[model samples]
Target: MFGIEINNIQTDKLFDVDRALENLPFLLEGVPYTLLLAVTGMLIGLVLGFFLALARGSERRWLRWPARFYISFMRGTPILVYLFVLYFGLPIAGIKLTATAAAVIGFGTNSAAYIAEINRASLNSVSSGQWESARALGFTYWQTIRRIITPQSTRIAIPPLGNVFLDLLKATSLAAMISVPEILNKAQIAAGRTVDSMTMYITAALIYWPLTMLFSALQDYLEKRYNRYL
Candidate 1:
C-alpha cells in the first residue's frame, strides 16, 4: 500500500454561501414586480409597435413622416434618459406618475421604437400580392392585416421581440434609481445593511439567472413553433 498524507485548506467566508442563502429570500421577493414591469411594458410596446410599424409603412407622407420621426427620436435617445424625462421632468408640467408607472411607460415607449422597425421589416418580407389577394377575397384592410399579415409577420417577429423582452427585463434594474424597489433595489438594500456586497450580488444573480433561462427556453420553443408555420 502506498501511503500519502493529506491536509485540509481552510477558505475565507468572503463568499459565504450561508449569507447568500439568508439574503436570497429578501432579494427574490422583489422579482414579482420586476417580472410585472417587463411583461406589461413588453405587451404595451408590442401593441404600439404594430400600429407604428403600419403607419411607418404607409404611403401617405403625413402618416409616414410622423412615424419615422418617432422611431428616429426614441431610438436616438438612451432609455435611462427617457426614464428621467418621464419620471422627473413631467412632474414639472403638472403631469405625474408613480416611479414604477413612469418606468414602465418610459421603457415601453423606447421599446416600441425598436419593435416597430422589426415589425415593419417583417411586414415588408411578405409579398405585396398577399395584400391584393386578401382584398380580392372581400376582406377588409383591417381584417386582412389582423388575420393574414399579422399571423405571418408574427413568425418573423418573434425572435426579435423576445430579444426586446429580455432587454426590457434587464433594464428594469435601472428603476432602482427611482426607488421602484425591484430586484436590484432589494439587493442593494441587503448589501448596504449586511456589508456583504459579493454575497448579496451573487444571490441576486442566482435569483435572476433562472428567470433569464426560463425566457430563453420559452423563446426557443416559440421560434420553433412559428418556424413550422413558415
Candidate 2:
C-alpha cells in the first residue's frame, strides 16, 4: 500500500435531514415542470407509438420498413444523446426549439420506439382466431382490428404502458441538461448553495421514491381491473 490510511480519511455527512427538509419547498417547485414534461411526452409517445405499431404490422413493405428503421434507430440511441442532438443540432439545421420543447420532443420520440414494441406485443397477444372470426362475420380488416383487436390489446397494454410512463417521468431529469429546471436541477442548485452534494441528492431520491411508488400502485390497480374478468 502507498501510505494511504483509511482510518485517517474523513467522510462527508450523508444526510442532513433538516437541511434537506428546508430545501423541499424550493425543490418541489420544479415538480410541476417535471410532471408536465413526462405527461406531455407520454401523450405524444402514445399517439405516435400507436401509429408506429400499426405501420410495423402493415403488410406494405414501405410502411413496415420505415417503422422498423425508426424503432431500430431510436432504440439504438441513448435518450440523453438523442436530447443533446435534437436540442443542439436542430438549430444548426435552421430550426430552433426551446429547451422545454426539445426535452419533450426528445423524450417522446425515444419513448415512442419502446411504446411501439409494447403495443405491438399486446396486439399480437390477442388470439388469431378472433381475427378469423371477425372475417367470417363479414367485417373488413380495419373494422376487425378496430372493433375486436384494439379493445383487448388496450387492456393488455396498460401495465407495460405504466412502466413506460414511470420511466419517462424519471427521464425528465435529463431535461435539466438543456436548462429546463426540473427537479434534479433544483437539487443541484441547492447542493451548490449548501455544499452538501450527498444530502441534496438523497433528498431528490426521497422525493422520487414516493412518486414512483404511487405510480406503481396505480399500475397494479389498472392491471387488475382490466383483467378482472379473466
Candidate 3:
C-alpha cells in the first residue's frame, strides 16, 4: 500500500497534460526569440565565414595565419564558455552586452568557424581549370570569384550549411543559462510555476520538433532549387 502511494505520487509529477496545454501558448512566445538568434547568427556566419574562407585560402601569410587562428580558437572553445565571456565577462571590462546580443554574437562567431571550413572545401572542390579559364578571358580576381566561383561553390556548400543552421537552431536552447528567454527559458518558467518539469520540457520538445522539420523541408527545397541548374 505504501509502495502504491509512492508510485502514484511519482506518476502525478511525471506528465500533467493540462499543465502542458496551459503552457503551450506561452512557450510559443519564445519561438520568435529562438528564430531571431538562429537566423541572425546564420546570416552573420555566412558573411564572416565567406571572408574567412577566402583569407584561409589566401596566398598571403598575413591573411592566412589570422584566419587560421580565429577558426582554430573558435572551434576549440565551447560556445557556452564563449557566451559567458560575452554576456558576463564583458561587463567587468566596462563593455557590457545584453544577453540576447551576447548569444547572437557567440553563436554567430562560433558557427562561422565551422562554416568557414565548409566554405573552404566547397571553394576548393571547383576545378582549377575553371579559374584558369576565367583569367584567360580577362576576368579580374573579384570578377572570377563573383561570377564563376560563388555560384558553383554555393551549390556545393548548401548541404553542410543547412546542417550548421540546424545545429545552431538547437544550440539556441543554451541561451537559457544566460537568461535569454528563449524556448527553454520559457519552458523553465512554466515548469517552475506548475511544478511539472516533465510536462514543460515535453512541450518544449514538441515545439522544437515542428521547427526542425520545417527547416529541414526548407533545406530540401533549397537543395532542389540549386540543383535545378544541373
Candidate 4:
C-alpha cells in the first residue's frame, strides 16, 4: 500500500507538470506586457531620476531639500505600499488610472529614487579635478557637466543601472496584484483552472530566470564595451 501510494503521488506530480507545460503559451502571452511595464517604467525613472539627481546636487537649499525628501520617502517606503497608494488611494482623491498605468507610475517613481542616488554617486566619483579643470577651461558648470563629466559618469553608472533594470523587471510581477495581467497573473489564472498551483508558479519562476539571465548577459556586454577605454 505504501509503495502504491508513493507511485500515485509521483504520477500526480508529473501530470501537474505536463499540464503546466501545455499551458506555457498562454503564460508566454503575458511576457510582452511584462516587458512593456519594465521598459516603460525604466524610461520614466531615468528621466525623473536625472532631474532629481540634479536637484539633490544643487547648491540651492530649496531645490536640494525637496529632492532629498522625495528620495528619502521613496527609498524608505515599501514598493508594494507605494503601488497600493497609486492604485487605491488615488481613486479617493479624484484621480484614476488603469491598472497598467498605475503599475508603471509606481515602479517608475520608486526606481527614480535609487537611480538618482546611483547617478549622484557616479557623478561624484569623477575626480574633483575634472570639475576644476573644466571651469578653468572656461566651461560653465552646466556645460562642464554636459560635455565632460556626464560622458565619464555614464560609463561608471552602466553596471549599477543594469542592476536597477533587472530589479525593475522583476518588480513588474507586483503588477499582477493590481490585475495588470502580467506573467504571475496569467500563471495564477492557469493554476486556478488546472488546480496545479505548484507547477504553474514554477513555470513562472523558470520564465523569469531566463529573462534575468538575458539582462545579465546584456549588462556584461555593455560593461566590457564601455570599460575598453580602461
**Index of the highest-TM-score prediction:** 3
Give the alpha carbon lDDT tens digit for every residue of 1-230 in model 2.
Answer: 67955565445466888999999999998888898899899999999999999999999999999999999999998899989898898999998999999999999888999999999999999999999999999999889889999889989899889999998998899998888988999999999999998888889888888888988999999988988967
Residues 13-53 of candidate 1: C-alpha lDDT, one tens digit per residue = 44788888888888988898899889989988998999999
Q: Give the C-alpha lDDT of model 2.
A: 0.91
Error of 2 at 120 (Å): 0.9
Report, for every candidate in turn, its global Cα lDDT versus the true structure: 0.89, 0.91, 0.95, 0.92
Q: Over the stretch 1-230, how does candidate 3's per-residue lDDT look in tens digits?
A: 55533433666667788888888999999999999999999999999999999999999999999999999999999999999999999999999999999999999999999999999999999999999999999999999999999999999999999999999999999999999989999999998998888899989999999999999999999999999999
Off by over 4 Å in 2: 1-12
Candidate 3: give the clashing pairs.
Answer: none
Ordering by lDDT: 3, 4, 2, 1
Stretches off by above 4 angstroms in model 3 are 1-13
Query: Residue 223 of model 2: what lDDT?
Result: 87
Off by over 4 Å in 1: 1-14
Listing every candidate in turn, what is its Cα RMSD in Å to the true structure after a full C-alpha superposition? 7.2, 2.5, 3.7, 4.2
Candidate 2 clashes between residue pairs 3 or more apart in a chain or in different chains: none
- For candidate 4, what is the lDDT? 0.92
